[model samples]
Target: YKAESGEIFAVNPICTHMKCDVKWNTSEKSWDCPCHGGRFDCKGKVLTGPPAQDLEVVNLEQLIEKDNS
Candidate 1:
């Protein structure tokens, strides 16, 4: 995610609510969930939601390794 200061960050694509996948909103610069109107900031903090928690951070390298296996 891109902050107002232009800092970039990354977080999991999954929503904390209902385990729904989140989509990036480039214009708004946040992750949004269609399932329950959950919203997360670039830092993965909950902006608004049926979700009550921040988005989880995932290890990309581990995920890549797992995918290849």
Candidate 2:
């Protein structure tokens, strides 16, 4: 999760459709799955097909646990 305006927002690094890693595209302000082309906006909204569901917004608690592990 990235911190902004005193709050945090983050998503799972992997895509839901095929378990592919989604990389951040700063220039495009979106996440794109390299394997299947699933796309999500920076806000985690579904921007393209193949993956119908939106990316999950990670909570602060979850993010803390992940960091600990």
Best by lDDT: 1
Give candidate 1 misplaced runs (Cα > 4 Å).
2-7, 59-69
Per-candidate Cα lDDT values, in order, are 0.85, 0.81
Q: Which candidate number maximizes TM-score?
A: 2
User: What does the lDDT read for residue 67 in candidate 1?
Assistant: 95
State each model's C-alpha RMSD to the native. Answer: 3.7, 3.1
Residues 1-69, candidate 2, lDDT per residue (tens digit)? 343565556787778888888999877778999998998987678899688888887786966899999
TM-score of 2: 0.73
| Colliding residue pairs in candidate 1 | 1-9
Which lDDT tens digits does candidate 1 get at residues 11-64? 878888799899998888889999989989877889996899999976667878
